[model samples]
Target: MKFFNRLLIDFAYYLQNSVAYQQKRRFFYNLLENDEYKYKKYFDICMIILIFSSVSILIYEVKKDVHDYLNIFNSYVISFIFLIEYLLRLWVASSVSKVIINQDEYSDLLGREFDLWFVTKKILKEKFEYILSPKAIIDLLAIMPFFHELRLLRIFILFRVFKLFRYAKSFQTFSSVLATKKFEFVTLGMFASIVIFVSSVLIYVMEANDPNSPIKTLYEAFYWSIVTISTVGYGDVVAVSKEGQFVAVVVILAGIAVLAFTTSLFVSAFTEKLDDIKESKTIQDISKNKRVYLICGYENIAKEVAKKLLLAKFHVVVIDDSLQRVEDAKKDGLTALNYNPGSIESYAKLNIDMSVQVKAILCLREDDVANVYTALTVRSINTDVFIMSLLMNSKNRNKLIYSGVNEILYDKEFVGLVAREYVGQPVAFEAIHTLRSETSAIHMEEIAITERILAKYPTVEKLENIKYRIVLLGVHKKSSSKFFFNPSDDTELETGDFLLVIGNYMFIREFNKHLSHKGEV
Candidate 1:
């Protein structure tokens, strides 16, 4: 027995820490998200609807005098599907991937390879644990039609309603709140049960022998007690005797107190729950965004850049260490996360690595070390992601460059450059001012020759027509790492090439609108 137990423990270790286990976990979690896998989400939604409909049918069957064969057939069909789902879930536990990496168990089990006995043990462990899981139990009860003797199992069909909580965030929050306050609720329940019982007995004793009493039996007295305590006293039941009337008054007063206390508890819990739901909604919104401008620091420069980005109709996600700055950003109508800006863990929490939607990350920290460190971390996660850093001192610009920052803006030098431009040409300064404002009709925009643009306009000359009064400036090719300035008409456009064009704001909007609608607009 000891030898077998040791082997089982080793098997459980591999099963729990395998690559397939983590992959399956991610797959299921992503399926609940709207933007990740649409088909999987649809499958989950269909199953939830079917489960609820099945329960409703079972309820209908309970009340119907005439038995419907169609209902039985439908139940069988749903059960079969559920059975398949259950089996699939169980099968996924013994994942196909044999190797595990970067896990805590990897160090201890370094030299071991998967063999026949290990595989068998892992499979057994998976099946054993899954059969004991809460979802599996619910699934089993849902398909209890196969066993006619377990008619009571139909009561567990109500668990189907709770399965919706897995998909709906609001429902999940509500359920979590209830679970968190279960102890308090249970205490209140016990007190209320005692109140009802005591009141019922007193009313029964006081009014059982009265000539004008509507309450006679224990059940009738209990019903009267509950109705009176609930403050919904019907005139059909009343206490005729003075003693019974006094008891009724006391019960009414107790009901008022109970109602007030219960309402307060729910209100208090809901207030906290609202904040949680808000954060969850923000994460969901982030997940749905196709691209966002990620601002690392919440400094003045960061704020200005974020405002411009927002005005340009680009989604912006701000990460700040200071809670006050995060709140300020939130007040300004930007989605802000409060955490360590330099930590990759913070980015992970925001699902940065999981999303290809981070268009650019702007490091606006005054501290050079922080900026360099953060830029390196961002590049490590996304090699192709564009990174721009704001430099308080020109000397630290190389630090940012060495850390793989794509662009470095010397804030001090910018002040002198602005003065130079303003001294020579007022119109040039105004043009720049208008461009920075993000609302001017004439602005500079960079449109990449993505696959979509490649399909629409294959060459540089093909896109030089300027239908909306736009100017073709230059193309920044990713492969060459150089900008071709006004090349010949034959200069071809390729994927990853950024077309720098100074055009009317409306013209840029037209490109986005046409591309999005495939020229429908």
Candidate 2:
């Protein structure tokens, strides 16, 4: 028994540390639980088709005998699919090995013996809670028809129709909206139950002995009460006696009031969820893009950057806490979201981890503290995505840097330096400004040195022979993170270096084209 226990513990530890196991588990979890998964729509459509087909088969069998082939297909194929789905859901719902490893680690930290019974109870409790959930129960019932030997459980096959709730997003949203009004619904349900019970008993007592009445049994009266309260008075079940007629009139009035209340309740709940639903849809739409630049503010600097990026054909998404700012951004033709940049939940909602499309995050919020917090929150969730923030105060420079900001733009200092330079060298400043602005035809662009480029032009001297009106400004060496300006003619170029050149837009385009096609022939 001790050896068996040790073997179990060793396997649990291995699983906890295994990268392959973790990746496979995460893949299954995303496929099963994540609505934002890329292939989830295809999976959902397949499940919906299977569910509808199985339910249709069940309905058809009611009127006529299904062919033997059809019956076998429905009983075996559909049931097997549902059974596998149930087991996958159960497997991903909780990790027993995770619990065991965590408990063992905690026991070691405390210098105490591992409590096997305690860990066993915790694992069982987690699994039991999942098994008893509403969706899990439906899944279980939907697969019961596979046991054809147990004919009594075959009728539960109808539960397959309920499986649509798992695959349809609209159904999930509606259910969520209703769930938020649980208190109102519960109170309304209690009041309706009381009215229904009283009416059922009164009508049964008033017409139980009348030869002309339809409510001869208590069950019939109960059914009639339910139908009347729902405002569906099927004239087939009528109350002939005077007392029973009076009870019917009162119940119908109560039914109208109950329905009105229910309608208003649903309308209010849905009204409150409209914005949230729109935001969710927006997130889904944004996730489809191949790449996007995230702007964490909608202020002046952020607005200017967004405009430039948009003009440059880069996808830009702006996020702000102000609804007015978000609206303003949308009006300016930029995608915007009203979300708190400092909150971790906002990043999760944006699906930052699942999307590799976010090229860079810019924290341009005006407040230094908010910028630092946003940077920290972003860094906590994503370490690889480049982040740039505006440093509003010199004191917060270190704070932003420590928060994992890649670049800091001190607007005031830059503007001050430019003003001083303009005062001393007006002509030079004007020329530089014109070249950087859109009004000038001259452009500065960086060309990355690939293996092909190195093979064709091994030295900076070779670039001089190109048939283009461009100037070699400098070369950026990636290995040393240094830029060599005006290097000698024989300066050797290496792979992964960037050539900084300035020329007319068309000249630069032709220069790149020439280099690309040079080695082709």
Candidate 3:
């Protein structure tokens, strides 16, 4: 018994750690996380297999006594297994929440880290209540309670079997889309209502006159009602009289009109809904595994910021109210979540707190008050986060400084200075390209000459290797805020002269090693 238990533990551990299990886990979690493509594909394949298997079994059962004791026993076993799995799933989900809540509590109680036994106990002790909720109830119904008597209740089995399809990604996506597109479905419902009204009236006027008509009574009007609206004119229920024939013409024309209207409505609604899903998916995808970059407002500057950030390979997401600006951001390859950045719920929707490694947030709202609010909201979530903001008014600088913004760029002051420089110096304007260009060979480096170089080369003449591939632009003296533009060879290199050397990656690597006795250490 001991060996058997040990073998089961090893098998479970192996199953948990296996590549296929991990992939399956990722596929389902991605579905929950709103990854459209991966989730959809995974679910679609599973759905096809499920539908095929269930339907195949149902067909086979049609030829035999499906209510046999062995078959009933097998179904009971399957249901029990499914119930246990569902309970385990709920337990795991609750444990994830507890890991956050109990970590601090356990650390204080144990005065040490969490152990495997405690975790196992927590898992084992998870009450049946969690899995017995509404969804779980539905799952229980789906797996248990045979729907009908001796005929095997194949259709009931079919319905119950569909519950397994929920575990697939495609089904989840379809559910999400149905939820988000509920309004579209509502509009479709209105059209359906109109079609029903018109069809019932036409069917009553036409079929009431026919002697052999199945749609004789008001309640029976529904039979012809469906046939007329769907344009499926069954010859068995013929309207032979002149007045009845007139009603038939109207019904057929109304059916054509309804068809056209429904087709158009579906196309338009689907297009709008598809755009929303795609934009939402894009933001979710980019923000999946990396740091967060927040854009406070939707303006021209915000758009420009997005362009620059996208170029720099940053996962930039925007929040703004202007419908046009949000639409423009979508047009310009930036994921824009529709929300006010100043709100707490807005941050939660964006999952800003969940991003463990956010580099910075740029608050560039047009209004000073709004920008300040945005900054405050960001700081509230993460105190240690780096924030840079655009101060539209210089008057708000003092207040912003007090709000924990590391740097604030006043648009008027910053842009005015740039304009002045552009008018005064053409060379300074040209140098901006070198600073921004990724492929430029003429790159600046801050080389710190240490004891290693001093010991190796006694004089500046021996520094020929450093001067060969690179231009010695200047030396930035560490102690002073001064630039020595052209230091001659006779100027002896000190321990702290951060040389503004312009060179390629190769020369920079070589120079870095020559100076640090640490030699790349």
Report lDDT per candidate.
Answer: 0.75, 0.88, 0.66
lDDT of 3 at 192: 66
Candidate 2, residue 339: the lDDT equals 89
TM-score of 2: 0.72
Looking at model 1, residue 318 earns an lDDT score of 87
Per-residue lDDT value at 170 in model 1: 67
Predicted candidate 2 versus true structure: per-residue lDDT over 137-250, tens digit per residue: 999999888886688777877888888899999899889989999999999999999999999999999999999998899999999999999999888888999999999999
Clashing pairs in 2: none
Report the C-alpha lDDT of model 1 over 455-482, residue by residue, as the tens digit.
7666776664467677777889889989
Tens-digit lDDT track of model 3 for 196-313 = 7765766677777677666676655666656766788676565566666676677678777777766776566557678666756665664564686777787878888888889878
Ranking by lDDT: 2, 1, 3
Give the candidates in order of TM-score, highest first.
Answer: 1, 2, 3
* Separate clash counts for every candidate: 0, 0, 0
Q: How close is candidate 3 to the true structure, as a TM-score?
A: 0.53
